[model samples]
Target chain A: MSAPPNRPVFAGLTSAYPRSEELVRATRDLDRGRAGAGAVETLYAASEKEVAALEERLFTTITGGYLRWNDLFRPIAESWTGFSVGPLTRWLETNTFFRQPVLAQPPVRVPGTVAARLPPVLGQRPEKARVLLPGPYTLARVLDNRTGESDGAVVARLGALYAEELAELRALGFGTFQFTDPYLVREPPDGVLETATLDAYRTIDAARGSSTTIVWTYGADPTPALRTLDRLPASVIGIDLTEVEAASLPAGPEGVGLGLGIIDPRTTLPENPVETVKVVREAVRRRRPSSVWLGPAASLDLLPTKPAEQKLLRLADILQALRREGVA
Target chain B: MTDALFPTQEIGSLAKPSLEELRAWQEKVPFVDRLGPSGPDLLRGDAPEALPDLRAAFAIAFLESAGLDRVYDGEARRIEMYEHPIRQMAGFQFLGHVRSWDSKYYRKATVVEPVRLVRPYHLDEFDFVRDHARRGVKLPITGPYTLADWSFNEYYLARQPGWRGRPQRWAAQREFVVDLARQALRPTLKALVDRGCRTIQIDEPAAGTHPDEAALVVEGFNEATAGIDAEFSMHICYSRYEALLPALLEAKACRQWAWEFANRDSGDHDPYAVLRTLREYGDTRSIGLGVVDVHRDPVERPEQVADRIRRAASYLGDPTRIWTNPDCGLRTRRLDVAYDKLRAVVAGSRLARAEFASSRR
Candidate 1:
């Protein structure tokens, strides 16, 4: 069977050299002990400006690399330790400087807020590409919930919000969306979580025309969720070629597209072209996936700056080789 | 903080309870309850009525003679860590299902409504120990980052800028955590401080997982200990400490940082070069060096515990600042084994302390 049409391999990039401009400015102001509202505003303004510039720079790729929009929103959350979702919501609604989308859902809804942020950020890039997300399974693994909500309830709501956001993204000219689920590798996901997640994806997939490839990334064995994968209406399912242990290859669908995450984003280990070929061969032998594409398992945020760029170049090399082998 | 840290001791974890003694203790101890699948009953906190009997147990057992300085109420009353107080608090939903964060092999923590400590669960545990132990008692509670790391992420998942829904809920939840820290942790710690809980060792196995979020974890701890004047401590073990070391040293909230030194993987030695690297952070805090390995089959002797403590002490550059301890908490151990190990800890401390004092002279 012929492989499904694959999206271009997008690699992460670094710009403005060793120093992040926002960090430098924040550090400088912080060093001067400027702890006033002006300092805070200046720092945030610089971050907003840098983020916009980053989106432009990523698309431009001065280094001749494909762009991966990784952790742009996450860093905003990370920098402010005091930033809880509650204050963030209040901040977005109260501030006039924060522009609400003209052709967007109301900001009161979680998905709408995600929708409002997407067009500006995703729209900035002219490239037809897939977007990355920490999926419901993974997102549930990383938060503190003192709000008396069950983890299931929390993840279900998030999945619903994500489905809405994914639907909104499809409307905003994004064709291929990759949902990054790292936590799935932690044994088989619970049956209930798996069901909710599959349902969420089906909702998003049906809305987005069944063409978007939702890729699960990071170190995980997908054998347990293979049934869920078969039923979910996505066009392609990305597998981490490196971490999808050969023993874990489950007997599943032949038509499902696969995003083979072969590159190591977190380490400086040079990608051996020979070893990679062997992995790709194994993936073909077992899953016989519609398409087996190679990329990083997770975001470059987990890596130090130097290793990230090196890994990106390795990805570029692998992409060229995979095309030559007629694997795409 | 005092110059002295964790004194070397026998690992007081699983004491082999003969069938007869087990039955006798069960009948005698009012709260002889078993928790989880593993059968070590939580003993001291809520169960034992008074300090005198606990002291008598220590005296009869010669726990002090064994060289153990810090004592626990055998986790006597606690059903599980973090859940006991959360169950007591208002606005908590006990989901009734116990789920492991990763897999069952690593460790298991219950999922609950985001926890804020309104009252200290370990209070009764500490009070019983304080009333009885001739030496200082170590207070154990689940650390803040562990609380944050182990909870559900619905409140923290990726947010869209205009989407304010999850963020609003997250704010409320975080408020509960911070408020819990303020109301429950602060007062409990202060009460322990007042009750002469000289060495307050907060147990935070969760901190190691999200070491990248060290600053936030440290901030939470600092907030918890804002106006307290006790030798604050933190114990984490059996996992990667590399991510947490930098943030912990940077935070400097705890006057002492204790961790497991020996394990099957670590080969009965200092796991990482933590003692040597700890000096890089400078010498403000004491090190509760785990000389006794709790996970190992054959119980370690006082001399073996002493040797490890000596090595850690040398690495720490201050013998006085080194405290000896088990690699982890003894919640997994049987009562007989637990008492035996604790006795070894006390003995080991005497050996190491004598060695250090003689060397100084």
Candidate 2:
């Protein structure tokens, strides 16, 4: 057979910069004794500036650069107007904190709340932008079970809300959408969480029409639930190769695209571009991929700004390396 | 306020302004500029030329403004919780920055050599507050397990063994941390006791970060506080207190356990839900109830604090077993927000005290 197709790599699933920037602004505001309702608006404005600066910095890079939901507090519950945002809460494993959106009440997507809040600089470059989210299953996992409902019951409700959120983004012309399930790797799939997640993916993908929908799984092994993940009606599915043995990857449909999280984001150890190319190349050969995307196994929220930035550059280098090697 | 009701106190480092605030203060304040780039560094043992002792005196006065039954220096001189202690100890050196939570980081130190005391770290800082304080003063020190928990174990990774050729890294943390508690903290506790520091609060924010490691934490606390005669109090924030309660009860040296109940209350506004958890483990240790939510800027209503305390009292079955405090430290908040939260702590404690005393009559 002809040389395997060289995949596109997106190096922008980064949480290091804007969250850091917004945190600095919160610190500045708090330091200046600027407390109360007005500070929230000011924080949002400062966040927009951070976005503009982030876009301007990443504008020259080849692979697509993302405009992140930097101030996204707890995953799903923050969609409601009443779920007031709190301090930068601790993230599991990584040293980074995300403004965890607290889901207190039944989540109803208030108008203007769910819309993408990119600053004009990135907002102008919609082609390069893909809206990413903490998939419904992951969002519902962190939520406290205050409602006395089953996990499936709560997940289903959140799934519907996520579908709505995705539809809104698609309406705004965000053609490429990603829903990341970090918890998929962390928690063994309770049957209900998997089914609810698949349903949510189908609802969003079907509603958004022929747009490219990528369900990127990371941080834990989805090996047990791979078939369920692959069966979801989406254009592409990303698996974390860090958790999967390259040789044992099962054969799959050539039509469904592949996104390999070939680089580890949790460690300070630098990645070898030559080795990264080999990992994806092997997966492509065995799986017979239609399309391939290379990237870090998860969000680069674990690394500090300097290292996270370097990891993004290194990811781009791997793509260039594969292109030169021909069997890409 | 009735003595039978639990008394309120301030936790360590009550929202010290971010270094950003210190930089701002450095630019404006004439005397603090001489202390260094960060004005608060003066509070440590290393202040240049002993800068007139004004800041430590002000720390006591600032806490006195809150009217807490017990007060602390609010850790004005040191950096964030873990770094200050590591800086004072030998063998530990800053390798680089590590993320603790979202965007917040503490300098990750590696214990490359055997740890020893640079000297007694908290005595002079404690003495200033003790002499100047109008309220009873509480000196808060970083507990050893938390110090080990937040650190990168470079030394232990090399030295400790699980079996043949395999270095048991997890077990290594236990030994290294227990060593830090038993041997490392001895000098500071002795020095503080010698200086007549009666109330010692061990700040263990990392105590419940990992639920499985709860037993190790208790072991560390017991080792760290051995033979020090002062009253021992412990502070833990944003953890699964349910998992920790059983293991933490083993820290008999720790007379009271302070928790961040108000901080837990943030996501769910349910008033009774958190105290409901506290009531689950009945009558083992004096529970320090968090009435003020320190993470948020909004000042708590006094009635809300009183109501939370009353609910805690009913469930735990003794009002006296309860103590009052803010959910966590005020370090990341503004000075104004920090003081206001303390005011709520005092005001709410008053409300609860009055209600309890009247009901008894």
Candidate 3:
């Protein structure tokens, strides 16, 4: 039986964007004591505006570009209780590194930490904004868990903290939240991860009132956790098409949306829009998702400014081709 | 092996030279002007010929003054470990900077064609160090596996277009790494050995990046140092050392394993837990035991360093099998910090030696 065709929406970057040359210079200057805090802020604001304008042109959902964030966990690590920034650790197989969060005690969310870190432009169009966060599973896996809690318990606690943050963000008019879980696919799926993942998402789902919740997994193959992932409480389940073929994507739960990671963000080579649309069509046909979001397979921070921008433009081109073909 | 118990050596790299320091060395070293313009700044693309040699002289003097048993030029002649070697090789073009961690960026390159060594990248630097240094020298070269892992492989991926999966990528990576070992690193190692450089440390921080491909590390090492007659050691830092144990044990050419344990475990609680694990896996190779943390600013007391050596000694069952050093390259630390850390290592080794003598009595 042929699966029904579904129209897909464009979701811009679900993680940090590569810093522009000017922003990079400003950051270095700030680090070297040549530039003041205000000067750096000015540059960040300008970059944030440019990013917002670019996303407004191409995306159905927009982000603040995460220009100020050093890494995915930096903001939380700096502001949250019981966590401190530790030594540099490799982020999966990539050359990039993140300061691992050292948890001394149970994690507790500090009020307004997320909002303060976010670009002010996000507040103006909260209805269209999407906030990217590190998923509980990934956090529990990456952090130096010194709280003496089991991995499962740590995941649950982090999920509860995120749940509170989500409730607050939802009240602030944010429309979508993407929780990236690279660790889920990197490590083998066990009973502990499966149970903890479900429980954590359940907590996040309960707190997120009317806002879209997405659980996006990348960096490694997500095939092993497909069964557990299909049953996630999130509104959308994202899979890296670069890692798994489009045809191999199993059917998702009824009424669940799908985030199709069709573009490869790690490489500088430009992807063909026609070929990308074909992959999206195949994934939609197999998964039979209620809705879809087209995006990069992972974070765009690994690439340079020119290549990252080109990747986004390619995504815009793919969307246009999809529209012409009556797929979206 | 040195006659001294708990012989100390530098891991690699001292702090980078300041502009004033470079100028001072240029004035002092008479041959600096005759060396001609070389060593292109990877980021800016300007050749500063005399600067590198002068920098090497400056670093060698520092290490010798610190009283280390084995010392190199502190990698002062190069831009960094990755870019310096890649810039000297063929078929690579530098892309923009990529962040390694907070506020730190390394110039990354892509393999556009089959890579080959243009010349022995470290020979000039080694020659300068040999002329200037009073202490025994161990030249640290970036290993073939690390070079392959750090680079983006455009050439090999293009070779097999049909095999499109993780397995295919892995296959391409293996081919790229092996080719590097044979084509690039082997010739380089041979030239260094021919130059009367006895001890060569192959720095492979990326050795444990892929646990499944641990065999590739062994294969690369063996291929690079295949016919070269020299004492070879493998230096791997800030990695999953346990994952590479089986392959590490198989790497017969690597007589010593210079690994970083101080940064993670300082012998405070679970004293040298990873060392215990390595020994349990039947590892019998000499260890370059890291006693001081390079990332931290506070200097470790000599007694604290002795305690770390003592704990590692307990696991190895032989003090002679242990060599004292800082966790990794002191390039990350300040100049004063690196100097103090090195002094601590030297002092700590001496303390450990005295304690061992007393126990025997």
Candidate 4:
């Protein structure tokens, strides 16, 4: 599975960045893990170890850049719901292909399969790419029917399930997984759902055979939420630049990757590319992550079909440029 | 004056109607007016028993004093959610609600599935407003295209209809929603028009949601308003108006584009930057410039509001084509805050008009 011949010209990274064979190998390795809590959290724990012999072996076998971003277990763990997950997972899988925009019950997993399917559609995007899954809180908020259930019950069950699935992905081989929990901002000031979200991350951390970065995208008005955030075992927290004023961001995270989402994923308006590069550079100067992954606040689901394509191209351009600057 | 406030049939006061109560709802005095540390509109759904009620007409005297050409009962009779009555009806099915990221207020609404329109305005809801409303009232209703665009369509009609069947259910659904606009909304507009209601404001918050899909919705709206000759208006705000920018210049069914000039995307206090964007389209329709801020509030100074209006007039290149308004609907604000905000808008418009006349001399 060599990279496709028709891969679009990207500006930032090396020409070899879009290697299809490497992506396929990474996908296969990622698919081999067990489908439970231990597998998921162990991935998170293993991610925390500093480039140890064992960690190097795991990252090397996974192709490259494995322990970088958060939500590594998601694409794999959420997929198991195919047999044991909620009704939405079944609906999404049964009706549409992984990336098809139809809304069904959203799946409970990371959608690694969707990631694997993207190279062909995206024309061999960066090899060993990172895929993002909705964070626990956002999942809880949007999927909740609130008929007879409390948010904690939902988080606990899903967390246990996520932990097992995340551990499985580590065993299989995923470079980075980004978990997005935007709903913490929407949760009641002193609510149980917020507590359960942190608990779920801890469960995953304890279970993963090794350390992995847990990324939180779209956390804004980050107050009260950020108070408890640094304590969570996850590695990185992705903040939304479009939603939260950059001034509101905390001074620094101890060792977490600062996932800065500078692009607007929801609207079709093209971002000024120069301004985008400047923002990323400033964040690098200020936050100084061990690494920084540039992307949008969320998926480009709401954009029109054509504009969505343009958005992906723009993002690819940004990432490529960042790689040239050695930031990724 | 038509006797009612809303066109629907579910007449009842969801909240008390009072001019003074509407004036006090702002969280801040001048800047940062809408959202507050304690939160805005938190005291609703509670009762007040202590203060002796003022029985006279003087209590509401400020409403007319504010100088609104057309006024509403400020929707005092209705509660927070606007679409509840439609949802409570037998046929409409419930879909989960969506929240505005900026404002925590939730709009609980239903998806009209299987696509059918049975009747016009709920006669029951409109009758009371009809009886008690002031003269020449403006009637507000959500548009049809917005309803279809907001909800998820279970079927995309991807399947081609064979010999016994028809193809492209999406096209059919689009037509269905438009037909609903014609059957339900159009008649409601006509009823108001027939009753001597001179101005009707149709609120289409969802219009800007999908810019590419806008032209499709506009066709339906155009059909709904074909040959009807009342002063027609469309109110939209808190949105990036760029999507519908081209449509505003087409001079179609709407005679005025009543928009929020002081929203997050529109900029905080100064609306000139936003009004300038619509400069090229000024000749197509009147600009319902929101001179007063509605979100947070100390009432805007007459000078500040007047300044905004003058900016709109300059950018629009014509003072006559610019109308004064608040950025968005005041239903979410406190009653007192809303009244004060409206007062600033009226006073501001007067100052702008006076300035224009002096300049002519």
Candidate 5:
């Protein structure tokens, strides 16, 4: 199954593809003195080979130029969250984990922060590289806020720091950025914090200049926060439709794009392609979004690598089926 | 200053491997850089105690070197908080793997048969610490409620005679927990007490995670410690303490409370915000203040920790009801980092102890 001729549907990871447990086990062997460090490289190289194969099977030409850069994993963000990123923090209400980016002082852009540490492959499709980073407000929420500043102060500081990092990524040739903020959806801002959070996103968006910014929210429904998020001047808004009924999605802003995450990364159960199409069609029909994309409801990192891989394969088949139906 | 605040005990887990302990594999795998050297060995059971003790010795050494007033074997004998207990309990099988935060997975177990203790789990480790410890050692037992909360209840649920509804499910869950409390926690506490163990901390992280089950948590604690005499504690973190409160007041008599504070200390978020409820309740339960952070490996300044103790004391309106500790376990850190952080915990505790004692006089 494939898209309509000359159709423009894009299929890609909204966040980092999972690092396989085999690679982790191999790395563990290196750590335990049972194997040489080169073993890790060998295994990781093989893992990347599989990732390349999956990308080949699933992604479309509209997304062909954005393979390796399309999904910058947690290591990049954790290692470069401008502070000594803390130990892996558990995602509340779920079984998944993330190495929390500690906000000791304001997060800053040091000389070699993330952008400088890019693998050689990141440069190949530099023009269309889609880089993922924690959004300013989300980053602030997870931070070990060392300063006794107000939430607004923390948000502004984080927004400025994220701006600096995004600007650096932009300078390094990354054009599309997905700033993830799951907190906004899980607990929409009320009263004064809402205004501050909105202002903070505006500051971050302004700093990116011409680069595309897709502010993504997961872990909760985005319906209530839609109005506030729409005013941020970002190019796109990514919604997690896993929890909310597709019928409940609001008719959104005219110019901003909408990406509906229809795939469930938590389980290996095959998603019905027909039902998925209906969800997408309804979102498009109701929201009248300027542009639309299909992806998973949240970071695929939450799943074990096997389930994540299966979900990706399933997603690929569904997209292929959608394409065969000539419904881009 | 409301009375005695002299002792400082570590919350549990002192696992920090030095860089030298890591294998000679580097300069290769780009992704391998994220994992610390405390990798595979972290999931296994007690390596036969090397010399005086294997993993326990290093932990005791650090706490001792830091000059803590109380200590433990640092939970070096166990793999992690959940499975270590589940492994020793009969009728539970390794069901599958579950994430222990992120990336890291713990072997999740389920009871396919009736629950029973294969043997006393904590005594051997406790004996080692008891022999070598310079101060009082606290043995941390994973609480009955947490053991029930974390595990899948195959054993109890299957035996229910009819259609399993919400109430039946709840009954099955409670039966499994209380059964474990009778078979595991109570017996363990009795054995430890019989061995002259004076302080036992029942870790109930799951209690705080699910507040709706607070009563069961308290029930587990009460049943586990009934007729058994010791300085007991209920340790919890990353929870909504509000839900546990009022109810937590009931169980405070059986044991003092040890909680994580520093890691949750978000500037204006005020880590000590819960002390108000504690103060309002007027039950003078000793509060274990987590002065050191376990979330990050960064060693805090000694003064930073001292300031935290002072702040906790001030808010509780009583200087004497406080104890200094790390926010949680130190298992994820590098060895040197854990040592340095504990040193900070000790130093900071000393500074605050002197100031607090003097201020009261």
Candidate 6:
């Protein structure tokens, strides 16, 4: 499960890559009633395959690309009982938006819903493939909880559902599960951080059997929550390097992996490999943890297709350079 | 303009014509055929040259029928708000499409060098709209703050490699926005004013994206329209209006704050509570109140629109300072839906005016 000496593993964050021009056109046509759902699904499948191929070459861990997802919460919102997709809310500060999940009642996991939403395994080794989900804390923060339950209760319920989803995915042969918690860093709710948040992570960690769990936090600095996040029972803790300095990062608990977000996905400006290497080296030198996962600071969906791919290529180059120098 | 209690205007941009709609318009207005043949290929966007005049004529006709007091040609000649201005400006290159919401995307660009206007970008569109329109025209221009926030800034970032993180980002953004105001937007506004443009609406929907940079938005607005001789208003929608306010109060050159409320507040109860934030911040400028929700297909009842205006008026304490409009542009709606929405606004405005006159008696 460990990366080889002096080499850091690379992976995509929670979301899909930006849709290609052909896919964009197909989706648009479907919106305009010029094309059918089947036509758009065909394009989605094609796009997922293209992304899987690219990730297979550039990343140590592969992703399903989540091409069918309109937003992070859509599949769960649509499939799960007692949850409905609401109006478009801006996703953090980015131009992109997600349909907020509105809770009518306590959520119930409908069997095969998460499985059906997942992409068909596109020829990658099963152990190297990862599925991304919104962490319970983030899901609780973003959702309109009309269930009339306390925030803690909502987190606990969502945590149980995510755990079940992770267990099912693990049985289906995925080896890595990344729980994205952008809201946990951006705006953590009162009191839940001390109790429900940590318990939710524990619930998910207990369910993930022999599979690696990554808690990726982005869109804000995680310095204040680093110690609390380090105590979670996850394998790796990802922080957005674009939002914080390398020197500011503290070392995590022994044996916990470090997900070093070296590339910024929001900007179109290409990263200089040398400058990225310096950041990785400085971060590694300071927060010398058990392992390293080098990747973009946030979802690549914010970028255009070409720039998103170029960023991965640049990350690959940075990883190679790091390996050559025995930096990690 | 009509001497009404609440004037009605659209927040620019009607729906672009479908091929069938274009053909129908050509048949109705025979002069449209003078521009080019009404063919299917024209609707595919290949014949931008032949379509602008026809499109403007159709839009003006539509607005005239809607009976709004203040009207523009629905920005028919231009592309979507962002790309239309950025395409004409120097030092920017179209990168690719970025999603704004579900199934909706815009072609975003990168700032490769210092940004400047290539020419008067909106002159031809303005001239066509002015000559053809029967009502008073209100032009909507993309503001510099939005242009800087939306684009990828390489030129500004490249200037200060030594500085790092948020400080560097803020500094570069300030320089880029101010430069855009000085070099591009100021000239465009001045030219529009010189060419007899009366009311210019500077659209800056990205103003509240960064709450910390609210002052930056105000600075950009003030810088762009500094010496321009015209009535300048600002239209910001689907944003954190509360965050932009206190800071937006600093925009001295801006005469009105045109903002969207109907989209967020469903007009059920105390729908204009957000308007209280403007009053709290001492923003006493004229308010372009958004009473129609443009995102939905079902037409809001004239009573609902009037109710919204009445509630907003209670907060402003002056119906004369309020102008009624949709939450944002109707470009997102179908053509029929957009027409119905505008007609509803006009009807609602009349109803409110009648109520105000009765109350005075």
- DockQ each candidate and list the results: 0.02, 0.14, 0.37, 0.03, 0.08, 0.40
When summed lDDT is taken over every stretch of 10 residues in candidate 2 chain A, the lowest stretch is A59-68
> Which regions of candidate 1 deviate over 4 angstroms?
A1-328, B1-65, B99-120, B153-179, B191-196, B264-272, B357-361
lDDT by residue for model 1 (B6-45), tens: 4543222223333345445555442232222222333334
Error of 4 at B60 (Å): 8.0
Question: How big is the positional error of residue B179 in model 2, measured in Å on the Cα after superposition?
Answer: 6.3
Candidate 3, residues B61-93, lDDT tens digits: the string is 667667788988889878889999898889887
Local distance difference test values of all predictions, in order:
0.51, 0.65, 0.79, 0.47, 0.67, 0.79
Better of 1 and 4 by lDDT: 1
Docking verdict class for candidate 1: incorrect
lDDT (tens digit, per residue) of candidate 6 on B1-361: 5577898887879887854577765454433433346533454455657567667777877777787777787888778888888888889988888777778988988888888789877988888778867788899999989888888877888776842465667788899999999998999888988889989999988886676688998999999999888888999876667666688888988889898877656312254777787777677788889888887788988988888899999887778889999888898888778888988998988898899999999
User: Mind giving the per-residue lDDT tens digits that candidate 1 earns over A156-198?
Assistant: 6656665666666676666666665655554445667777666
CAPRI classification of candidate 6: acceptable
Q: What share of the true interface contacts does candidate 4 keep?
A: 0.00
- Candidate 3 similarity to native, TM-score: 0.91
Q: Model 2: how far is B127 from its true place, Å?
A: 2.9
CAPRI band of model 3? acceptable
DockQ score for candidate 2: 0.14
**Candidate 5 per-residue lDDT over residues A1-328, each given as its tens digit:** 2222343456666765655656556555665678886876666556655665566567631122221232222434445444655544545433344555555555555644566444344456556455667676676676666655766787777677667777777877788777777778766766666777887778878887888788878756677788777777687788876656667676777767777677755433445667677667666666766666667776665455666677777778767776676443
Evaluated at residue B116, the lDDT of candidate 3 is: 82
lDDT of 2 at B314: 78
lDDT per residue, candidate 4, A1-328, as tens digits? 2222222211111001111222223333444442444554354333323212221332211212232221223333335343222211101100111111111332345434534422221212222334344565555554423234565666666677667656655554544555666555534324676678778778877775544555554524455566666566765666655544443455555555566665553333455566567666655555555555555554433333244345556766676666566442
TM-score of chain A, all candidates: 0.67, 0.78, 0.96, 0.57, 0.84, 0.94
Report lDDT (Cα) of residue B31, candidate 2. Answer: 35
DockQ, computed on Cα atoms, for candidate 3: 0.37
